[model samples]
Target: MKVYNYARIIYYRSPLLVQILAIAFSLIIIFGTLLHFIEPDTFPTLFDGVWWALVSVSTVGYGDYVPTSVVGRIVAMLLILLGTGFITAYFASISGIAATNQQLFLKGETAYKGNEQIIIVGWNERTKGTIDELLTKTPPVKIVLIDASLKENPYASKGVHFIKGDATRDDVIQKANIQAASMVLITADQSKDEVAADMQTVLTILAVKGLKENVYCIAEILTSHQLANAKRAGADQIVETNLLSSFVMINNVLSHGTSPSLLNLLKEVKDSKVCLQEAPTALIGATFLDVTHEMLQNESSLILGIKRGASTYVNPPTSFKIEEHDLLIAIIH
Candidate 1:
């Protein structure tokens, strides 16, 4: 039984084309020797017999050589039938394998070759919007998606590449080329509970950060309680999606139409959208009031406030000094 299992493994592991060619070559050689012995007087050389056997089996029957003996003709007939059958089956098998490989490549089983691309781990409604928004940038960015739930790429554009695998796995992160990625965004799994989803996001964050410490990682968390855990897991940014959703709901309850206004403010219009742009180099030593007026006059932007480190101060005092590395929170549209 062990020997039988071993033989089966070897047989399945070998390529079908190689196996078919080996079998066909053996059959041709065997018949060629038999033909030479049976009709030694008709064929002076064994090479002639082998040549005849190949041509007959291939149905090419060039008629350059033929077996006059009845026994030799019978062998020729059997060789033609068996050879043609195997040849047809071999071609069919090759076509099937080529088709299967193409489908696998399209479904993201193949490794991504793009570099300096965005890596999006997991899938949700927010991810779709993010992808659409990214494609509209001044210079569009390539995005690599890693998700186990998707069977194939949902987007039809070439800007996005998909890999079907667990986001929390190191192999999957490596397949997405995390080391060369410009940014990594991990979305919370909607199918799992809040805690489970946040845990999965944290695990992915840790895996990404472990591989590339400098790669910017933004992770989505379902609950605000998991914010610290995500940050500890090495995420550079943690978006509390559930908390933001609750705030929107609360705002709608307190003031009707407030949610729509907030949504519009956050939505992207054409190529313009609200962003936290870095403070201009010339404005490093200027006061808030000076920079705000310059931005409004020159760039036609509304200066909301400033984001320094992890803290965001909205509508800070006009006298607040604008420092280097400060992010200007403003409305671009």
Candidate 2:
């Protein structure tokens, strides 16, 4: 009974298609050998017997090989009767597996096992827009989206893989293949209150960094008090949604028409994004004005600021001297 249960465990663990093919092949081998030996003249070779068994069971009888002896005729009849059903079952299993896989994929129960994929944790208008933009890029970016509230993949694009789960859990993060990801973007959970959402975001960052310390993470923090906690949780960048929204509203009220232009300006430069580049060795002691002029002339890049350690100086004095370890904040086209 123990041995039977062990065998059953392995049998169930094995793929359905594999078991079906194994049974089919076993049938072909047994009959092929029997036919070859039972009637040597008609089926001279084992290869000939296997070919006939395969063809006959598949319902493509070529009539090249036939059995005349009564015993051989009986064997042929038995092979056809028993083998055909399993052979037909093989094809049926293939279609069934494909349909099941498609269903699992649509239900967001499938795991993504690829590398360099960008994992986005949230489902909202923002995530939808971001995914749409990523899909439109040349040499398209691979994306895996994780959201507990979603029941199915929201996008029909093959570029996105969706996993429905809590991002703060290890099992879900592993399903997203976070260890092999290039970076992760975590948005505040809209289902929770502001404080709880920020806590969730920070907890997610901790879970991700614990698995892959070097994987870059950008987490959204809804409350100001959680800013230090998010930083401590190993987020490479923090998107202060509340601060940004407040600033946008303030700008719209004060400057009237500038907010639209500001947003348009960002859209216009979508192809190029702001990045931190190692400061040119030659610009170590150069003035900000000189370095800016040189970059604009040589690289067609506009210098945005100097980032030193945790501080950023945007549009600093033209005479500010560039330091050895300063990172040049610029939009490289």
Candidate 3:
């Protein structure tokens, strides 16, 4: 008598199809052995008995080999009935696994592995402008957006990624690759207060900075009062949206239709009409007056501000000397 332990093998691997296959195989093998024992000389060898078992269970009934005894025939009937359910279940499990894998591949969720992208926290009306401006100004920059309210991402940019969650949480920030991010832009949610929004932004900034101290953080604030608090929270820069709006409104009132022209001039990109350029190290020792002529002549640019190391010398006159590592924001034509 050959002993085959099907239950033990099925227990360790335990899948629906595997369990069915084990049960069916066990039934066929046990019945074939029993047939051999019942009619000792009737059944040839173990191999022939297994072949007969397979044929009987599958309902092929080759007729070349047969179990003539009543007991053997009874076992054969049981094997045939059991094999039907096993075979059906086996194929069903296979179809299920295939369908699941296909769905996973279609969603593109399995291949999310990359680094050094900008992460934008929160989504609002400003998000549209932020995305548009970033896309226009910076080429080939990858952005990961984190927001809880967004049900579906409306924009379909190639390199943009979206994570649905609260950005204030550490795990959520990590999902957006906050540690490896080149910059983190925190925009206030439209429905929240300026202080509350700023608090959230500050917390995100602090969390990111805790993970990666070198990470650059920029936050948008609705009020000027939150600017100092945001700065204290390790934000590299704070953009006061109200201040910008007021400046634009004032410009429109003062210059009438000329405000549009001024805006166009400030934001011009192609043909180097008006450009902002960082100061080269070689020009650091020179005075503003020395670079003024060169800037106006061939460069066709005007020096608007001198960034000396960490300090900004805005609208510095011709007498202001340029310091080492100073960035000169200029207007070129």
Put the candidates in lDDT order, highest first: 2, 1, 3
Measured with C-alpha atoms, the lDDT of residue 332 in candidate 2 is 83
Better of 1 and 3 by lDDT: 1
* Highest TM-score model number: 2
Best by lDDT: 2
Clashing pairs in 2: none
TM-score of each: 0.69, 0.89, 0.63
Weakest 10 consecutive residues of candidate 1 by summed lDDT: 265-274
lDDT tens digits by residue: candidate 2, 86-202: 888889989888998888888889999899999999998878888989988888899999999998888744658989888889999999998899999999888899999999999
Please say which candidate is ahead in lDDT: 2 or 3.
2
| Window of ten residues with lowest summed lDDT in model 3 | 104-113
Q: Quantify how close model 1 is to the true structure by its C-alpha RMSD in Å.
A: 6.3
Cα-based lDDT for every prediction? 0.86, 0.90, 0.73
Q: List runs of model 3 lying over 4 Å from the truth.
A: 1-112, 133-139, 270-278, 295-302, 331-333
Clash count (model 1, backbone only): 0
